[model samples]
Target: MLMGEFWGLGVRFRVSAMENCWDFLQWLGPDASTCVFASLDDPSDLVRASAVSRSWRRFVIANGFSRSLCRRICPEVSNFTRAVEVSSSAMNQEVGSSTAVEWESLVREHRIYSYLCRCLVSPEGSSDCIDRCIGASSTDNFPDESIENTLEPSDRVYMRPSYWSSGGEADPQVPESLIYRLGSDLCVVNEIKIQPFKAFFQHGDPIYSVKFVRFRMGNSKLPLRSENYVTDENEGQAAADDNFVWTYISPEFPMLQESVLQSFKLPRPVLCIGGVVKIELLGRVQKQAMDGLYYICVSHVQVLGRPLSPKLALDTSEASGASVLKYFPVDSSSVAPNGASRDDEAREPSRWHAFAATLRHLRAGGAWNQAILNTLLRPVQFAEEDDDSDEEEPYA
Candidate 1:
């Protein structure tokens, strides 16, 4: 029988199933291939789309699915074994209204599922379940440039160490003075450990408090955390409990005020986790009074923890400068040579290579930490400059 005839025989997608499928297609519309391309912006959600059925999965693979999408989607799919049953009635170029709805629903469901999976599976959230899904590959050798490009920047950003701190006592194991540069001043941000349930600090679980302070240049002000915080009441919850103990440090009055040298306060400092904390640096600022370089300062920070508050909550801050800096596009020049391929044409160093090098050092020993730290502080000064310098290259 012709494809249309099959549907006329009452062999239609289940009503509920049809609805779900159409919802997905609405998000993608007629050309699923381009919709899939749009999904590349979010690797994790794209993966969820791949798990719906054989047709969808095949489409993802054929389109060169991103590694992060592969990682984020495969595990979250409800049943990898189930074959997606296409509706014969909808096979004709002209799809029925009901069938169209079903197709859109199917794609929507896939995207949502993929996003939820990433939120729960990321290391900053639930690490255990995700670890089992992608085993030894977690620690496998760093892939070459081509493979590295397959991984998304969102996945690679977590591979580096940004900040560390912890507290259950007067002073935590982490340093008392955190040195972060802002403009011309090398601001020495002070760290004071405050525990939940303590008399002066007692208010809420996941202790949340807010302090407002003036943004004086010479003044060393430590802002108060918000009045709302996390507490023991939120410990075992599946999602973040704002009531659970969390902290915030601000240098502005309303607690949400923007300042020149701002920093975030975390519920606990993470040291044993052994990964870098990455920050999104926006080079634009709103206040005209601030200096040109003021945008380089830390805008906000969050601490990602599981159960209660697994990820750091960041406050929005306007960066300094009138014009925002454009992101440097990844090009052939950014591809660095591998250990065995060092003799190849000089390639520009990739951010991924720097990230991989840091992971490598972490696997080695303590000295590696210092090495990675120095590299992060001054990536431009690395000796590997000669080996991967893309400056003279015509393509660069």
Candidate 2:
């Protein structure tokens, strides 16, 4: 995907220049070009097609095809107000020499969105995004067995309790939720894995597993100030739900009373903006022998997804959960810097830009729906049709 940065600036396309590559913009005009390019189904194809020719690349940028493609794959991307890519001063001087600076901004958008589309749909690998435990609904032994322990991947380690324990509750229906902060501002989540803890030290090795569990992903309304950070040391100081704006809520999943880690793959990959995850543990199925009260315990939890970082960042300055995508493209001599690239610096947008944006909007309505229909007609790797009915319950 790093090569995408160069493709956005037409770097890779320079050597492959040809006189006649269908030259759609010249032969058929903008409307026909819209229907043809917007019809491209794959994000990778959309990016590579830009390298066909200079007109083709300009048409892709001016139309915001990359953005349209992304929004089609992941609807949450539509929430972004706009995308910005910062360029260096040397690039600014280059843009200063050009009369049409708006075109440069569009090129930046082309690169940024191509990268985003790749991250959202065709992620390469998995990583847990949990930065730290924000808080837990309850804790039986505070620091000894707290939500922080869930961050540890192992169920047992170095004579320490490597799990989180909930305070005993009289009613099994009482739900408990754990809050966590993902290190990045945005993460594309595919699945969440949870491991129930087996108290090997205790007699009979009881496993404290919840009967059902659910998940919520969102962002906090305000920046997490250090003074208000929640931790195992802060007893009963969990972050409240009122502080977040949840964008995705998963269906409740039944849990097994076993020590093995269980995976709950989402129906579809979700774009987690603002990077906050709330794991809701519902329906306690285990009881502490001494107190004879219901308790929920978890050994490990993982939100498996790709977190775009280093260059890509979110602008949290706006309301929480509504983060705008920001891309920092490594500026070449051709890139444009802020003041020089600002659209206001240019005269009224050329008809090509205006018509292209309009065409993208129209094509998005129909062509995207057609693409979705075609996608549904075939098998998708992300979606599976399996039910838990065939699995046997673990012996408690």
Candidate 3:
């Protein structure tokens, strides 16, 4: 059966089968070959397959199998409305060739998605993913028992009470929340751990905990600085729910009334694109003796996940809350979208040499991390520069 034709911006691809052919792609045609490649669940398999031959590499990338596989593993990637090449126009002008620029962009996408796939499959690291505390919905005291106190793992720092308390509310159904910026702009959250406060100084040493807890993850509409804050704004106005565009909201789980570290794992790993997590404490469990109001108090909080950064970063400058995934590959000169270089003749070869090195390692059954990924993607460094350093580079 003949598969329908593929319509690309500048290139048209036709899919038709042949009666007899020794080559795999020739006999199966583009459509069948694409399905076979898409069946591969492992990112490493796709990388090794790309090394089989030039035709195979072109088919794999042109079809965008890596990106599809990534989305299959985590559905949340769909929120990235679209991808923007960091510097496309500069590279396009430097290439000065539409044909080469179109193909080169495909290769760049392959490299990016390949690296991202490997990163996503990695196990959650031991370090906590919380980078800084944004704010709390309510704070009973001005600064002493502020939201900042929850950053410390321990309930007390020296002689201070290290816990955040919500302003006592007469209604027990009132909900409180804590907002925090994760360590990276992108993360895969598997679970969250929270510790309730134990009022040791007070008589009877009562524990203040919430009856239920829920989590929200997304990007802030306003830009957030890295500095940890303890805003003195009124309880409800500071960390208002309207300030963020949440992408994931976990089901409400019952919070233990004990003063121990409690863990609540999600149904599945959630992809936090904007890297902001809000913890909502619902139904206060403890009532203050001095007053008839109830409140929730938390001593420490932690979000456990894998941070995809130091190689990749999220650009949230857009007003729509959607992000642009930016690439920061090590070999900037060689990995340009259109194979940029001062020496026009060497431009195309430089990109291929980087891929060849990667193939060599893959052939040896080597497992690559981000460091190895960048190393293999880097072309050999030239000690000397071309005489026309200011001139543009293009694939000839």
Candidate 4:
């Protein structure tokens, strides 16, 4: 819902602007169904009304029209029941007649059941869950296909013959696992003998896979998945370890790479399935690895900005190079080189600059999050202990 984006950004709060959007929706009210269905392909994920609110979320869930949306739109496992249940119960309770109540209850039950199916059957973070959930009928969407069941990591490990040479007597370096972009941002890490499952948030956003590098100037290497990858039966340790790696390349900016951070960008207007969760506030903050990179679980979006459409297309020709899987023009100015509009391009600089600037601002605002910047120039801190231990104290 680009209109909603306009609304979300507070652009439409003006009296005239609000009136115009309302009138436009009314004019296209009869055609809204067409628009909503057509929106499945909308480049800007923010434009889809389903991505807009709980009210809209309820509408799609009840109608059962956007079966492809279940995976992406369904709430996170933590919030699924809360977002859907509250809405469904309220909708059912509001039905005035007994027959209508029964029908609504049936619809609610189906929606709940479908959501549960999504939780069990869909791959964690993959939009395929949405497809399965939406397509499931009462007869078909069983508990076996619930979202919980699908989170099984063993099932996630894909086993297939891969030709990359990994380990050796000394350096076990396999040519990198081929990364396949499932969507603009969604991708699956094709690690052979393990599951080939990777999921970026919402539909079609940038997904990143950092192969756990375990080497320095001289050392043996370790793949994240050793044949004997050990953890509890529940795999909590492994799951916890599989956080999004937050890296702080510059040593001086260590604090900038806190365990958590946040910034906002309107993603491409795709149908939103799940409610967003604020996971940054859940635990005690801690330091990560030396490079300020630590695994973090955070929500990221692959928005379909106008520029990314042409810029992010897959070119098999470029597969062998240091390819940009997808690029989000964070600032308006960056778009000018590509020749977009001045207004759109103007926002590009600020947009992208936000990603880098977000950390600094959040720190200033006392928000509990961090940001990463490409290393240009950074200060390195010297250890105080080294200075105190020096034999020649003054200038050693």
Candidate 5:
């Protein structure tokens, strides 16, 4: 009987010890637990960890673990501090909800900061192409060097020229504007880079650049599919007068008169709500050779930002529109269009030929002429030959 009682007591003690071991907080001190959580580089990992137990969630929230990690990764997100404070204040004012609100605010801040951190570390992809150009009053678009070509990554020297006079001169006061549509209505932009185009073929090879550039973010009310799209006809109109409003405006920054790619970073990350970005090549233009007229020319332009998750809310009432823009990846061909057939690239040439032959035979009925059939039977090629020639020499 004595032995049995002793055994039972030992069993109970072991069970209690096991329970104590399971209490992760008590096992790992607060400082050690924080260090462990901070070691997780990915936000997704932290989220999974939070799910393991309630204590972990509380620890994460109280320490602002995700926010600290985000700041460590991208220090530019300092602008988020005031936003967090405002949210906390607003939450505290509600009756019987102070604790709940604090927890909720911490969770929200963790999600946002983690997202920004992910974007900062993610690989730079293709440039988010601009949907249209707005207020480019006097564009000198050559057939070979159209304004659209400014986004291309070819060896060809693509440039957008604005001529104010017949002698290939431009006005210093007038600013050329380009509007780019982002993939998401709400995105975080980080940096923007612009390369000024130099007319090297012409005498004196003047570089067309502005003294400074400015940027704005807002939504456009214009219909996307309308045939009567707005253009330079309303060039002189201010942005407020037009359908687009400037929700956020960047400070005017001076531009260099060289052909190198110059970068301009935002004061902080901007949450652009409307998906539209307006770039204003501001200030007086650089001088021209013979006419002495000023002109602003851009060889290439890139906007970089992290695309927002589809699950995130689109509410912008309390968000700031002061984000960054980054350049797209250099290899544009790798980016597949939405809804495109992925299998087209996977098939071998022989398999494609077989498929084409089968298709031709099925359509060999009456009215299908041999010439037309032959044309249809030919395999379509989508690959573009890579060009390795240097497009432009860097300015001395």
Candidate 6:
């Protein structure tokens, strides 16, 4: 009788174990698959999960798992799906079947958005200097001061003393504008830093400080090859300002009244298709002693972003045609009697006077013309020049 009882107990245990296994399988249905995938953070992991089995791939594609992951990573790309759908539909009418077109479009969006997400989250593998500043603009600049000076990197208190300034006039309502052109047609701007200049030599307090600053990204009506600078004809006029139509406007940020570098990060990554950024100094809190007018000054300005390259290697042959204005400061002590660097006596002019003479030489060859010079000298304006009806292409 004891032996019979042991056999019955063994049978009961086996049945129970089988039932438990069955129950666990039931728990892993479509709903459970979704729940598991939803918990995953990486889009690449989700793609790998889809390849595990036919059922998982179906679940990922049917429920749009990749798309959901993209939305979660970059909420700003919410419209990407609708835009892709429209584009896919238009393409479907051309050749492929509707189902194939839809599938292809979904895959494309997942790939593009996934790449963008990686760019935002991943550590920067390398840092290559992207020369995008085609030109610069300012509202008012002091004589002997150049906006190009702000692009240089320095450790001095006044990195580049040659700064753009609002004229010696106090008007809180009139804001100063500084515009920078991205040499490329489009770039992904990540960060911008501005260092306000302080006149330590002043008596009562440091004058020419910026109190408030804002930013705007927009498209330019002019061709990309054209120099992006204010001309003498449009100086202090609204027409120059009208040339650029702002697409994305940033919120106003308060600036510290010191010479320290201030950084402003975009709320989210922005696709700056317009290839131009305009920095607007809304409040001038200090006045200059010599001029007795309100002035805002900046020692340096920097734009940190990635340039888009379709090809593996960028063709820079055309880049020569693009006018790039850069300044290199010369150490007076290193100069030889004949005005050359110690190492290379055949070096180009390092002094301001010699540099100006070289610019004149370049201008004579029609390489640097009046428009380019005016852009370097005057402030950009904001008025409509002509009634040419050219509309910007919609973002895809």
lDDT of 2 by residue, 226-286 (tens): 3344442354343788888787889989988899899999888888877789999999898
Tens-digit lDDT track for model 4 on 1-396? 464464454323333545554533334464674455445522232224444544444454455433334334422222122212232135347658887776565454434434333323334442221110011111112222222222232222123111111111121222121111111211211111112222222244222122231100000111122211111111111212122121111111111221122222212122211100101111112212323322222112121112122222211123332211222222323433432212111111222222323332343345543333223112222221111221111100
Q: State TM-scores per candidate.
A: 0.20, 0.70, 0.71, 0.21, 0.48, 0.58
Model 3 clashing-pair count: 0
Model 2 spans with C-alpha error above 4 angstroms: 1-33, 89-99, 121-123, 201-203, 236-238, 319-322, 331-396
Q: Candidate 5: global Cα-lDDT?
A: 0.52
RMSD of 1: 21.4
Give Cα-based local distance difference scores for all models: 0.26, 0.69, 0.69, 0.25, 0.52, 0.51
Write down the TM-score for model 3. 0.71
lDDT by residue for model 3 (134-240), tens: 78887888556667556667786544567889899999999999998776778889899999999999878889999999999987777664223333222333367
Candidate 2 root-mean-square deviation in Å:
20.1
lDDT of 6 by residue, 210-314 (tens): 677888775555544323333322222222567765656788888888777788887766645445788888777886767667777776777777643221011
Which of candidates 1 and 5 reaches a greater lDDT? 5
lDDT winner among the candidates? 2
Q: For residue 5, give model 5's deviation from the true position in Å.
A: 44
Q: What's the TM for model 4? A: 0.21
In model 5, the runs with Cα more than 4 Å from the true position are 1-52, 56-131, 134-146, 153-174, 221-242, 245-248, 265-271, 289-292, 309-396
Off by over 4 Å in 1: 1-32, 36-48, 64-274, 277-396
Q: Mind giving the per-residue lDDT tens digits that candidate 1 earns over 1-396?
A: 542342233223423456666533344454865554444545433444554555555455444444334333432122122212122222362455986766554543343333333433345521210000000111112221111221122212334322111111221111111111111111112221211111112232121112322211111122112111111111111112221121122232323223222333432222111011112221122111222111111212222233211111111112421111111112222333322112122222335344554453353445556655655534232233322322211010
Query: Is candidate 1 or 6 superior in lDDT?
Result: 6
Put down candidate 5 lDDT per residue, 1-396, tens digits, no spaces: 353353355345545767666655556688876776777666656655565456766787678876776666544344332332122233354456787766676665655555545565556663443433333434553323334334543213212232221113555676666566555554667778877777766788777777888888766554332122222222323233277655667888889888777899988766564567777887655676666776677766667676543322232333353332221112223333321212112222323423443343344333467767667655355443343333211110
